[model samples]
Target: MTDDTIKEVLKRIPYGFYAITSRSGDDVNAMVANWVMQTSFSPRQVALGLEKVSYTYGLIEKGGVFAINIFLKDGADALKPFMKGRSKNPDKMKDIQYSEGPETGSPILESAAAYLECRVVRIVDTGGDHDTVIGGVVAAGVSSPGEVGDTLSLPDLGWSYAG
Candidate 1:
């Protein structure tokens, strides 16, 4: 599918919004993605499909771990700025405001509804601009109430994906 069509299809797939994060040395990166999902329950695996060019992807490849913070609708306004921008900026995490993950160096946004710390178990090239990263969850917990702000969805917001 073309990038537009692929994004359109993906939009139909309901997803919990998340800011997946990773780091390499002082280079910390975080990207907002809606394509992440849990792939397994027995071993507690989660799959995150991120573009090959993402800074977070490089960090996961080099550092071997990643963290995910499922965002809440209440904070959607807080996350809109970082949704579509080059991640080379060292201060990309500035607006994000977070603490380091306990197990991984990944940044954990305190505003998230829930968070998960994971180690890469496999990385597969999904033949598009994105790679399918399957990881095993080491730790996970809900920071706020066991519920998200508003369960934001694409249809609910009427946004067209271009990034």
Candidate 2:
């Protein structure tokens, strides 16, 4: 297949957008992430693909915890500030309203449709642009009180993050 065809095919795969938060000491950061998946049903584990250079990755490595904030389909605009890499913008989480997850101490987005706090089980070198970090869910909850629409997805936002 042509390169463009491969990209289009990859884009066709359904993927949800999330605000992944990690903390180290007093530092906390959030980033727009699209490569996360539930890996195990028994233990309720999740695997997140994070670039090696990501500031949040560094925090997750050190803190051994993170939180996945599932955004609402109609709240994509609220997540725009976190779409930038924290390496370029150190204060990415500044002025954003969030609360510390009781289980992992990771920042949970106040406006997310749902939130999952996880404790890192391990990280594997993917030999790609991103490393695979596996985590076990410790706590989870729904942020919104009323009925919520579908979680935000790449196609819903007309965005592309993977090849």
Among these predictions, the greatest lDDT belongs to 2
lDDT of 2 at 39: 98
The clash count for each model shown is 0, 0
Clashing pairs in 2: none
Writing each residue's lDDT as its tens digit, candidate 2 over 1-163 gives 8999998888788788999999888889899899999999998999999999988889999999999999878889878889789767777688899999998889988878899999999999979889999999999989774443477887897888888
The estimated TM-scores of all candidates read 0.83, 0.93
Q: In model 2, what lDDT does residue 89 have?
A: 77
Q: Estimate the TM-score for candidate 2.
A: 0.93
RMSD of 2: 1.6
Instruction: Kindly list the per-residue Cα lDDT of model 1 for residues 1-163, writing each as its tens digit.
Output: 6897877675666566667878777777777777878899989999988789877778889988888877656667756655764545556676667888888767788777778999999999878998899989998767766544356544456664444
